[model samples]
Every structure is written in C-alpha cells, then in structure tokens.
Target chain A: MRIFDPHIHMTSRTTDDYEAMHAAGVRAVVEPAFWLGQPRTSPETFYDYFDSLLGWEPYRAAQFGIQHFCTIALNPKEANDPRCLPVLDELPRYLAKDRVVAVGEIGYDSMTKEEDEVLARQLQLAVEHGLPALVHTPHRDKAAGTRRTLDVVRESGIAPELVVLDHLNELTVGMVLDSGCWAGFSVYPKTKMSEDRMVRILREHGLDRVMVNSAADWGSSDPLKTRKTGLAMLADGFTADDVDRVLWRNPVAFYDQSGRLDLDDTDGEPKPDDTSSFEGNSIRRGGE
Target chain B: MPNSGTAPHPSLPLTPEARAWLDTALTEIATAPTTIRTLFPAVRRHCGRAPLPDGRTVDEAVRALLLAALPLRDQALTDEVGALHRYGDPAEQRAVLRALPRLDPEGTGRFLDLVRQTLRGNDNTLIEAALGPYAAAHLPADEYRQAVLKCVFCEIPLARVAGLDDRADAELARMLGDFASERTAAGRPVPEDIAPFLHPFTTSGTTTSGTTIHGTE
Candidate 1:
C-alpha cells in the first residue's frame, strides 16, 4: 500500500518520523508552506522558509527515501502582517519551481479582511500560474470559515476542481463536496479527525476526491495517521485497491494538475557506481 | 592549475540552432535585469529537456550557458551565481556547480562556499558536481583530498572526479591505503580502483607521476 501524504509538515518533524512514515508505506509527501508557531517579522523570513520548502526540505526527505513536493503560499495567518505582504511579489518565482505543485494552505485563518485579500490574490496567482490551490479552513470558526472559504473560492473565478478545501470535518465535508471541489481531511491524534473517523468519512464519501494526511508538525500529532486510517479501512472490509486510491492516487491526481508532481523512484539510497574504485567499502560502511 | 575547457565536450557540442537560441534568450534576459530569481527556472522551458550527445540534458547545458552569459563584473557575477545555486532546486544547483569551472576559469576562488555546501550535502549528484574542474582548480589541497575521499564514501566513481590525476598526492594515497587496510582486515575485498592511488604508498622510494590510474580496467 503506497501512501502519498498530501499534507505533512516534515520541516517540523524529525528523521525518525520520516523513517517511520516510510516503514508504514508512505512513499511520497507534500509539505505545504505555513506560518511557524510564532509570527514572522518580515518577508525575508518567509523567503527563507519558502526556499527550505523548495530546497532543503525536499533534499532532506529524499535522504530518507521519501519523494517530497511542496505548495507555496503566504499562509493565511501571516497574510495579515503588513511586513509579510512583500512575499506576494515573490510567490510567483517560487510557484514556478518544479517541486512546487500548488498555491497552498491559503484560505482564512481568522477570516480577516487581510486574510480575505491575501487569499483572493493567491488564488488568482494559482489561476495565472496554472497550479492548484489548497485552501485551509480556519480552526476557530470551522463551519463559518469553510462557508466563507467556499464563497471566496467561488468568487475568485478559479475552477472548483482546481481547488481543495482542506482540514475539513463532518459539518463542512458535505458542502465542500457539493461545491465540486476536492475535500482534504487532516487526520491528527486528538483534535482533527481520527483514523476510524477518517475511515467512516471514506465509507460515507465513497473515496472520490478525498485525501487523508497526518498534517503532522511540531505540535502533538502522529505522522502515520494516514497509514493507520488505511489499516482501519482494511479492518472495515475496504479493499486494498480502495486504500491505494484514497492514500496515493487521489493526491497524485490533485497535484498532477500542476504538471510538476515528480512521483519518480528517485527517492531511494544512491546506487553505488557499477565501476566504483572501492567496491568492498559500500556507501553504508564508507562513513564509518 | 587553470581549467581552460569551459565548453561542452566536442563529441556532444550544442547544435548551432540551440546555440543561436541561447544567444537570443540570454540577450533578452540580460537586458531585463533579473538574476537567478526570475530567469533560472525558465531556462529549461526555453532550452528543452532533450539529452545532448554527452547525455546531459539540454536544460542543464543551457543553464550553464545562461550563467556564464551574466555580466562579467566579478562581484555581481559571483552574487548572481551564488543566488542561483542557493535558491535553486537540485537540478539548477547542479547546473551552477557543474559550470563553475567554465564560469570562473581563472581559479578566483569566489565560489568555494557553493562547492563546500554541495560537498556537505548528501545528494550524490550534487557531490559529483562539486568535485568538478572548478573545485580541482580552486579548492584548497586538504579540502580537495577530503572531497575525493567523500566521493569514495558516497560510492561515486573516483574516475568521474575531474582533475583526480593532477590532484592525487602522497597524503591522499596514504588515506586510501589506510582505508584499503581497514576493509582487508574485515575480510572484505578492497576496491579495485583504489590500487592506483594506493600504489605510491605501497612502492618504496619511488612515487609514480602522471600514471593515468582510473579504477576500471
């Protein structure tokens, strides 16, 4: 069962998490750009973070045998900061990168006027860049936030199919589905949807455009929630093929819209040259 | 120890059409006044990803060409080249590192940090790129020796490392010899290619010069 975690903040996770995720059949992941726990004071900070998402993070993930792709955005919370607005001018350059698959995590946080404007602008950038958008529904007012998110998404004039309203729950799922957009559920440990609940959502939703991710980060979260959900589905009599669809193919289809999802098998350990000088000293032992 | 050959291998030189296209593209970009921030990623679309005769993609070659085309003010050129590598994806980074010898043939040592960064990285391709002609010409002797040893550590062919013959020294040979002994004591067969580098240490009172020793037969 190959799992493609459509949303996981590996920057906040450790190498242990990567190994565990790989051991649990997570072959690929997409780490969306989002605000750190603290507010960033300037756009220069955002540029470095975006560079990491595009450069360092992917390189690190590859070392652990995980193919990493990322979505670039200002993130809703930071969108309110006057200092960070300059990032919008730079978003197109990052958006044009090969590993950047979407304009992401880009919806309302507090649903502020600033968040409103930033979200709309990034959505337009998505449309212009021909990339998909990952819209984050606010945690505080879940129901209202998603509704307003849907309204903003509709008004942005981008195709609903090119949009995914993420961090959804039972209340918002039906509306997002009805809006012709793909639904993303972040299965976390305590707060977000649990594995069994995710399984139940799949059972109800019929696994069309639904994507299950750990959304694991610096907070209290489990990186293998996607795999656990897969197991729960299997226990509930869902076929392996069904698990593959929700876990792998669904995210691939969503990000493939960017025409840049390099799901190639380039994540494995570097193969020793066929004609290396020191054949006895494999790379594994050479370090020692 | 200057690296004079900045052009692609003769066997796989750029097509005249590709060359002309690159000239026009670089001219437009040069006038537009963006360094790597805007133009680096666009190189592939204009240059195409088809393989040249030498097996490197046209995109990679054209990126090098575009980088070398930057205005020749040393500091500005260095800044642009550094930004391109720093912010670039792995492929883009590789293009810049691979082109360093051609871009700075004088061995000015302005780009050692980029080479060092690549050496510190775990990406084997980037490691290979970091050990090219520019690194050979400019990297300090001690660092150069370590970089070569890193190639062995990463299971890369020592033959792929440019300037290996010119840079091979007594200390490097001794290190390879010590490594060979460690493997042999573990009852493992040593790397066949380490023999040339190891030969100087094994033979007493006579060090071979310009022996042309690459690992494969």
Candidate 2:
C-alpha cells in the first residue's frame, strides 16, 4: 500500500498534509523547484526556495515518517528574462549535494526562441553532469513543444532515456513515448488531465515505465489527486500491481538511478545533546 | 534560577479572562451555527451540529466548538473555514504533541505563553528547531544553497522564516535585475555558483550527473 509521489511542493503544504500522507502510506516524495505564484527577482530568492526544499521540508516530512527529495532546474517560462541567470549559475553546488535526484521541470512554455535556447543549454548541462533531465511541455500547442523538446534532446546528443517529458495529454503522448522517453501525467483538478482520463490512458498504455503525479503546487490543484487517481484505476479493474507500478515502483526506480533517494526512518523529535561546559562557555546556561 | 541544563517549567494555566474570551467566542459560534459555519464547512461543521461522540455529554460538542474557534483566533485557519487547516483537528494536534513530546514542554504550558511564543511571535521557533538539523542533514546541497540566497535577499533569519512577503517581492525583482547585470559584465552564467538552487521554470540547461529524468504522459 506504499506510495511515492514523484512531484509535489511540500513547502506549500501543511504539517497535517504530512501526517495525512504518511497515514495514507506515502513513504516518500520528490518536490521539484518551481516558480511560486509570483515571480522571484533575485538569485537569493531562488536560493531560499532551494534551501527550504532541502531543509525545512525534509525535516517536516521526517516528523510524519515520509522521505522528501527534490529536482533542481530553471523553469522555461522564466528563461526569457535575462535577469534569471545569477540564480542559474548557483545550481551546480546544489546538484552535487546528496538527495538531488533529477534536474527537471524544465522545458518550453511560450515556445519562444529564448525558451528554446535555455532548454538547449540546460540539456547540455544535464549531459555534462550525466544527470537525467525533466522536461515540462508547454500548455499551448503542446504537440509542438513536445516535438521540439524531443528534437532538442536528440540534437544535444544526450541519451533519450535520460529525459522525462511531463504534463502529457492525449495529443502528445504518442510522440513522447515514441521518442523513447518517460512520460509523466499530472492528475490535476479541472485543468491538465482528470483522474478518469488518467485511468483511460493507463488502461490503453499498459503502465510500462509510465507514471502519474499530483504535481500539486501553489495553485488550484488537489494534493490527493494521486490517491484519487489510484482509486479510479482500481475501479477501472486495474490490478493492485498495475496501480503500484504507476504510483510507486516506477518513481522509485527512476529516482534510485540518481543514487539520491533515501528512506530511513527516525524518531521525529529533536534530542540535542547537552554539554555542561565546552568551548569556553556553558551551553546549558542559555535555557535558564 | 534553574540549572542551565534544566529550565523551570512554567505552571500557569489559561487566565480567567482569556478562557472566558475563548469560551464566549466558541459559544457564540456554536449557537449561531452559521456564524462559524464556514470555519470548517465540511466534516467539522456537521460534527459541530451532531450529538457529542459520547452521545450524551456536551464535552464532544464543546471540543468541536473549541477546535473550530481556536484557529480563527490564531488567524491560522485554511481551506474550509469551520474545519481545522493542515495542522489537524485539536485532538490530532494534541496527539501529535503527545507523540513527539517536545523536550521543552513548558513551551506550550500556558495560553498566554503559547500566544507569545507561537501566535504573536515574529516566527515559529518550535517548528524551526524541530526542522533545522534534520533538514541540514538530508536536504540536497542545491536546495540548501537556494535557501541561503532567499534568506539574504529577504533579510529574514533562517530559523522559522517561511518565505518572502509581497513587500519583498518587488525588491527581489530589482535585485535580480542587478544580479543579471553583474553576471553579464563578468561574462558568466546568470546564477553563476547558485545555479543549482534555481527551479525548473527559472533555470536554463540540464542538471548535473547522477540525477534521473521522468517524462509526462
């Protein structure tokens, strides 16, 4: 009954959500860095977001016995802005850190030349680092973005298997799977893809290396969309194993390849060691 | 003074006025029903109207009443108004505290103490302390770098700060512009050393080695 959500923004969620997810058997999650509803102006702002993903979030998740991981990438929507580069320069240090499983959620939005250039550079970076890349296909003219994304990955000479094309609808699914890449479906509320549609896709596609996510962020999205989708799959007569593969196994297999996924459980509370006297000061006195 | 290793636990309970204020609000909301009806609006609202869990005692109703009212006073309500937000119902909140059992027990010992420490404070120190070390040990290095950058730009202390406020947004935008200018002059990348912290929407180029990529279907 365990689950692994490949995409979720835990920072936007509450502790109750952690507890609920744990109760529902979500053992781990991968939170990709994304644009907050508002734009970030400086590299420092991006820095703080990354810190929370790695810092406060994991700690919070641990309290509920869930493992937290993240993907680091510059989003394509903001790539056209020349101001976003300083933050981009600071990415390598984070990539080297343990627990960064993928470089993703990157791809075109408006299909502008700037987005194309940014995608190319990021693809090259992924190749240089030998990391897998997560591609976010544009909402408008998705077929074009998906095609262009596949072409760019091929043109860059990076292995097709190293790319994850996200937010696929019926129109672009064939091209993505045909391109020999992983296809991700974000089960959203009244927007991207519905749970029923997701189930239909799973039924037709047979769940071979395919995955589904809530992709819940700071928007009108459902955090329990994955669970709902799982329920739909069950109702649609999909076996528990099929449900498990899409919900848990595939994500774990994909992330484990990065060697960053860890799922050790710990006693949730802090138990800092006490010192009577050390370093020329008595640490215990501060509490008094 | 207590020993440095053991601070004296505060023994004060809720003040009569404070308890009375809370009780009064709870009663008003409970009687009117619709007034605080939006608080939890879903399960909690109905629970408030249903007979107590014990079937006869008013305490269950009272507890539900309090659960619905306390969050409003604290200004921490979310989602459905009548229901508790992501923190959980009052009983669940108590259960979480009991299970984890903060070492600094006196932190929430009194109503005024809780208010000063959590509700009225500049930050939630307890949650921050709880998260600090674990996050330091587990979060990937890139994410950590981004957090440091956020702390510097927003001028907030690392401990207990959630994020930049709207007021800081404009300043962050201007600072980013300046940062881009500096990078262009240096003929370097935009994020330079901080590239790993950028989100998928913000950065250009692929990730470093050892990461996996998944496509959307």
Candidate 3:
C-alpha cells in the first residue's frame, strides 16, 4: 500500500530506514518538530534544529526517493521550559519555508497552564500561517488531555478540520473524531497501539477520517508501523483500497489543506537529479 | 612552510590561484546551489586533487570552499556557508572546524562557535578538528584544558591535538599528573598520551606548535 505517515520523526531515524521505508511503499512522510531525547539549553539550538528540519532533512529524504515534510512548533513539553520560549519568536520565519506544510506536534503534555497558553498562541499562528495543526495529546490521562486539546483548538477559531490530534486510542479516538478533526493513531511495537489493536479501531471507526502513523522517534517507536498495519488489516479482511484510504488518502486530504504537501510520485514522475542542491551546497563529494 | 601544529587553516589564506578557482567555484555553487556530495567531486575535477601536508583531503578542500565563501564578506557568500554547513555531512562539518582559523582573509570574525560545536560533539573527526591549531591558539585556557580532558574522557589520542607542544603548561601538567595518580590509585594504568602532558618541559611540543609524540606507554 502507498503510504503517507502523517507523524514520524525521520531525523531520529537512519538513512537505512529511509531506503527501507521507500522499499515498503512509504512514498512520503511528515516529520514534526518535537522534543529531542535530551533537553536543549538554548533557543539558538532550537533554531539550528529547525534549520536542519527545513533544510537538511528534505535533502536526505530525496536521496531515498521519499518526499519529506515537517510541522514546525515548540513541542508541548518544551513549552514548559522558559529557556525554550524564545523559539516562539523564531517560528514565523521558519513557517514561511517552502516544505513546512504545517505548524504542528503542538498540544498539552501535562496540561500545565504554560502549555495551555503556548497551545492557544500556536493554534492562532497555524491560522495566521495558513498551515494545519499537528496536535500531540499527552500520554498520561490521555482521555482528559484529548478533551482539553479539542477545547483549546476550538477556542482558537482555526476550525477543527485544520487540526490533527495524534496518539489517539480507543478511549480518546471517538472524542477527537466527534470534534470533526483528523484522528491520528501512532501504531507502535508496544505502548501506543499495536497493529492488531489498530485493525480493531479501523473496523470500529470505519476509516472515514482516521489516519495511522508510526509516530516513530528516538523512543520505543516503529517506523514501519504503517506498512505493518496495512498488512495486519489485510490479514483481517480489510482490502487494499481501505488501507489506501486510511494510510494514504486521509493524511493527504488533511495535510493538503496547507497546499504545501507535494509527493514526487503523485505525478508518477521520478526525480533523477542528484546534482540538485538545497541552499548553496549539494551532497556531492569529490570522487564518484 | 608554516607548521599546521603552529598555524591553523583559519590563519592560513588559500593561495591566490586557489582563491581564484574557489571564488568562481563558490559562485557557481552559491548561485546554482548544488549538493556538497555532488559539488565535492565536481570541484575536484575542476581543481586538481593534491593533498596538503596538513593533510587537506578531497573532502577537506570541498569544505574549504564553503569557508572561503565566509571570508568574502558578502551576504550571499555568508548564506552559502550557512547552507553548506546546514546541508553538508559530518565530514563537511569537520572541514568547517578545520576552517576555523580567524586570520581574516576578508575581515570576518573567528569561528569560535564552530570550534565549541565540534568540541561538544563526541565524533572523533570533530574532536580532532576542535583540538587543532586554531582551537589551541584562540580557545580560552579553561575550555582548552577541558577539551584535553574531554579527549581523555572520549578516548581520543591526545597526540592528534595540533598545538599540544606550544600550549602545554604547568597547569595541564598538574592535571595530567593528578589524572595519572587517580588512575594508579584505582589500579588502572595511565593512558600513554598522558606522558607528554605530565612532563611538557621535556615533551616535543608546547600549546603553540611543533609537537609530536614519538612513543607512548
């Protein structure tokens, strides 16, 4: 099945993972700005990371024939740290970059008052920037957190359809779906939701506006979960068309709202130019 | 010849012939925007690949093209360096660190941040660059000493540090001596690189230049 993983941290992944992803029919992916495994002490570090996401990552993705996009945001957990708050000022410039399809991975981590304030502002930025929201719901007390996330998104007046509430499960999926936003499930080897459990959710939810992703990162995540979920769904009698709708079409429909989402294979024409460079430098080395 | 152990690449200007070639090449790269991976080999084809004594490898010369862009004092040139660093691979990053000499071929300031960045990373190539001559002469004494300790911590051979001879001081000797005692106290043998730092008076090089470790243990 052709797939668009709406939320996967490809920067944390390896080049080998990219090759394997292309092989597994992952034609495109959206890498969101989130907390690295370690805390950053300075806002300059965040900008440097944002620059890489905007500049380096896209170049890396293209080598493997996969289209890479990113959501720029001050992740929920980092919003709590005062040191990182200056990044909010740096957002607008990055949001203007060509491949930045969405302002995302923004939402409540602990539902702190600080997180609430940041969320409200970023949602407004999403509306201002004309980008979709990739909202990350907290792992702890997820049901209440998802509800709180929905309430805040509603408060911003950005429209529910423009927001994607990720890391949803049985208890919280219905509430997010009820709000008319895209419901994103992060299928994992464990924790979030397994492929079998995801198949069950697709069966219950009917795949109308639901999307699945690996949400893969430096943590205990799986990059191939979308491919795995498709196979699992096939085993459970879900047709290829159904897999296409959930993994490919839904994410495309949601993110394409930004109008910046472009896949190389969308036109079925492969980009053969290796000499192409981003900014001023190319990946070209001295010898063949 | 200026000893690299004394004069870092940043202090050394690219030869006039090299400067002209790099100027045209960088204009093509900066204006056209090519990948370092593609530009790296392509530039070498245009400019013959002769390794420098400081051992400027093919990748080093390609990275130097970006550094060359920085000293031109043009906004477009600065952006090119930023793009190259942003998009360049780790080998390219080490080249940036190697290019950190602040000799001001075009009056741009030193690349202390780049040196600090390389020192912060655990990558040996980066560490080697961070501890090279530019870092030796310009890096603050405390940070310089810390970088040496970091080398010991990361198991990088201290011999690779460029200015070990001219910069090695009594303080560094005490630190290495203390480190040796601690190792002896724990029944662990002191690392071989510690010998020169412990006895800098008799050692081959100072923190400034011309240091080489003949034998270790």
lDDT of each: 0.79, 0.58, 0.73
Among all windows of 10 consecutive residues in model 1 chain A, the one with the lowest summed lDDT is A271-280
- For residues A78-175, could you state the per-residue lDDT of candidate 3 as single tens digits? 99999999999868766765567899889999999999999999999999988999999999999999998899888899988898899999999999
Ranking by lDDT: 1, 3, 2
Evaluated at residue A209, the lDDT of candidate 3 is 81
TM-scores, each model vs. reference = 0.81, 0.54, 0.58
How does residue A118 of candidate 1 score in lDDT? 95
Off by over 4 Å in 1: A37-45, A80-85, A265-288, B1-27, B30-37, B44-55, B68-73, B152-155, B171-195, B198-217
What class would a CAPRI assessor give candidate 2's docking? incorrect
* TM-score, prediction 3: 0.58
Comparing 1 with 2 on lDDT, the higher-scoring candidate is 1
For every candidate in turn, the CA RMSD to the true structure comes to 5.9, 25.2, 12.2
Residue A212 accuracy (lDDT) in model 1: 87
What would the DockQ be for model 3? 0.02
Model 1 per-residue lDDT tens digits across residues B68-98: 6665557877887787787787778888988
Q: How well does candidate 2 match the true structure in TM-score terms? A: 0.54
